[model samples]
Target: MASKESDAVRRHWATNRKAAEENRQDGDQELADHRWAELTTEPADVDYLAVPGRRAQWIVPHGAAADRALLCLHGGGFVGGSQYSHRKLFAHLARAVGVRALVFDYPLAPDHPHPAQVDDAVDTYRWLLDQGIAPEHILFTGDSAGGGLTITTQLRARSVGLPLPAGAMPFSPWVDFEATGASYDENRDRDAFFHRDLVRGLAWIFLGPDGSPRDPFVNPLYGDLTGLGPIYIQVGGDEVLLDDAQQLAAGAEKAGVEVELDVFPEMQHTFQMAAGRAPEADDAIRRMGRFARRVLELETR
Candidate 1:
């Protein structure tokens, strides 16, 4: 159960989220880009790499042996989001798991369109394998659209006989881009932000005319899931993406994948961002850190 302090923080974050979203409504892309840029840091612990295909960059955290590398994807409706936006979250994962992470920049839709993001994800994984990173030592992580990318990449990798990663973690993933789920409508008011209309708008822009919004690459739950590795996901009870999390879990179970899921009630999307003050956020981060550690340990052994 969450504590009273955590409850308060949740409320505060919810209130602040509304304000922030409204304030930056006109500058969504700019805000996301700025967040992506924030990933650059000092101490030289996490090295950055610029790879081919969609301005891809990797974040390598120090302390852990360089052998283990995490491929992280950032979320922004497949049009926005980058490594910089997820600095704190990924850095915490690196420090806690004692491993380096590579935050890849996948191509966004509308401009780059479908197959581009998935292709970039596959290329990045291949790059990791080429660098001699063992399949069992690599893990995939992402949030929102990036979360979708993580799963789609896994599917594509498996189809091509690429070595699967040790495990995968996706937080509040948008699994069904087709918007066929009921929660997409029901959770609109429950979640502080993330309305159905907005998601659909973004979807139309990203998927383009040639793309089938329901295609498994765009909507992971619609694909075949057999023979995938262990997986875990985190989501808030109030987020519009809630159905995506639940349905994905069910699909993973049907596919015979070892899957673990954590759901926090009354919480909003990616609440872990408020970790400094929000107890819920702090607890979620701790949970994610612990999950990463366990996955890496089990895979390494």
Candidate 2:
């Protein structure tokens, strides 16, 4: 049975789904983004600074290490979401891991398509390198579409001869743009915020008419997964994207990469968003923190 708090989260997200559906019907993306920002609770101990040359922010938790960093990407189905909407969630993760985090806004769909987001992510990563952060000390993470970005960015870095990060942590990643996973059908009624129609629409907007859904950069499940560092993936068992996480883990393992995937029963997508308030979320973040510590060689707090 799900905990009471977890049930509360489900109810909360159910309400959010209603609002999101209405917003989708009304085509009010701006309002939807505003509501997302409003729903997140910023941590009191984390400080943020806007990056001068990039659409990114540095989320520095108190006493965090200067040498280690997590480059975080926000999830909004590749159409919505921004730095403001995801700052708090990344801040919580950074705080738990005892490291600074860089959360950035990448180009969205309809206005900007496939390679645009890839270009922006690569640019921001280069900017991080230029700032004197070593590739081995860095980590990457994201939720939903942003989770997919985490994997693609590493591939992009490898393609460009740039050093890859020490590890990656993706939460409920939406990697299969074709929506071919069995979970899409099995979890159809269980998942609150995602469905075939909605993801299909976002896929079209993100991939554009000319792009292929299986393009490794667009759907990382089809990408070469060898040689990337340790990866930790977390997914809600009830999410429609559950199979994306499973397939990614299996693919990475087959490629001889170290990987771990955890699925929380009855949890919703990105349940880590409730960190500090929900026990399940807190436990998930702690696990991620331990993974960061091990991979980045950070001293135990």
Best by lDDT: 2
- What TM-score, over all chains together, does every model reach? 0.84, 0.94
Runs of candidate 2 exceeding 4 Å displacement = 7-9, 19-31
lDDT of each: 0.75, 0.86
Candidate 1: residue pairs that collide: 36-84, 36-85, 59-101
What is residue 45's positional error in candidate 1, in angstroms?
6.6
Q: Write the per-residue lDDT of candidate 2 for residues 1-301, one digit (tens) a residue.
A: 5566666557656877797677845377666666655544668788999888778899999999999999998898888888887888889889988999999889988899888887789888888888999999999999999999899999987899899999899998989888888999999999987888878888999988798998888887678988999999999999999999999999999999999999999898888777767788888989998899889998644
Winning model by TM-score: 2
Off by over 4 Å in 1: 1-31, 35-58, 298-301
